[model samples]
Target: MGIVVALWAAILGALAVAKYRKEAEAERTRIRDMRVVYELQLSREIAARRRHEMTVESRIRRELESESQADTAEQVAALRHELASMRGHIEYAISNTADPRRELTAKPHGDVRELVVSDNAVTDADPGRTEQQHDQDVVDAEFETEYQPSAHAKTR
Candidate 1:
């Protein structure tokens, strides 16, 4: 009877140890799974934050670029308007202005018969005309404002 009681006591002790080991292993496995889930959540949060920051930065840059473009367009339009006004003023002045050549040629001022006779004699004396002489002839023709001598000067 003593041997049987000792054997039963030993069996009960072994069973309690086995149950404690199994419960500890199950708790460790649950902790590991919870840690994995927490890590996944942290990584997702960080990625979402980065994506939001990038989107905000891109939006700000686009708005700034659009504003700059608008200012540039306004400046261009103002410059075009100024240019048009200047062109209108220039055209009006040109239309109102008289021809300088016509004004200079319209009035005769001095007796030039003696000068003409002398120029003709010199040109007849020199049959071979130089480029300088031809240029002078052209200038003289363009600016010829000869008037007849007054009766008082002719009498003198």
Candidate 2:
């Protein structure tokens, strides 16, 4: 009887040991899996944060670029307007201005004989003319006061 009891006790102890080891191994596996799940969750959160930051930065940069372009456009428009105004004023002055060449030409020295002699001498010296004469003539014309296109000369 003692031998049979001892055998039974030894078998029970072995079963309990096996059950405890299996339970401990299962707990360890659960803990390891939990750690893996936590790491994955943490990585996902970090990725989401990066994406959100990038989106915000992109939006801000686009807005700033657009604003800069708008400012440049406005400045260009203003410069164009100023240039047009200056051009208009220049045209008005040109139309109203006296010819500088005409003003420089020697006036008749109030002596008819002297004027005739001078004119004759000058014409004789330049009997033959070239492109220089034309250019000088244009210069003279440019210096004359504005006159009616149809008028041959300014009235005395």
Q: lDDT per model, in order?
A: 0.63, 0.64
Instruction: For candidate 1, write residues 1-156 as lDDT tens digits.
Output: 999999999999899999999999999999999999999999999999999999999999999999999999999999877766654554444344343122111114653211111112334446687757755653443211125454445567
Candidate 1 similarity to native, TM-score: 0.48
lDDT tens digits, residue span 1-156, model 2: 999999999999999999999999999999999999999999999999999999999999999999999999999999877766654554455454354222112236652212111112232345576656745764554322223242345442
* TM-score against native, each model: 0.48, 0.53
Error of 2 at 57 (Å): 1.8
Error of 2 at 105 (Å): 22
At residue 122, what lDDT does model 2 achieve? 32
For residue 151, model 1's alpha carbon misses the true position, in angstroms, by 53
True lDDT of residue 65, candidate 2? 100
Q: Can you tell me which runs of candidate 1 are displaced by over 4 Å?
A: 1-13, 93-156
Task: In model 1, state the lDDT of residue 140.
Answer: 43
- Model 2 earns a TM-score of 0.53
Best by TM-score: 2
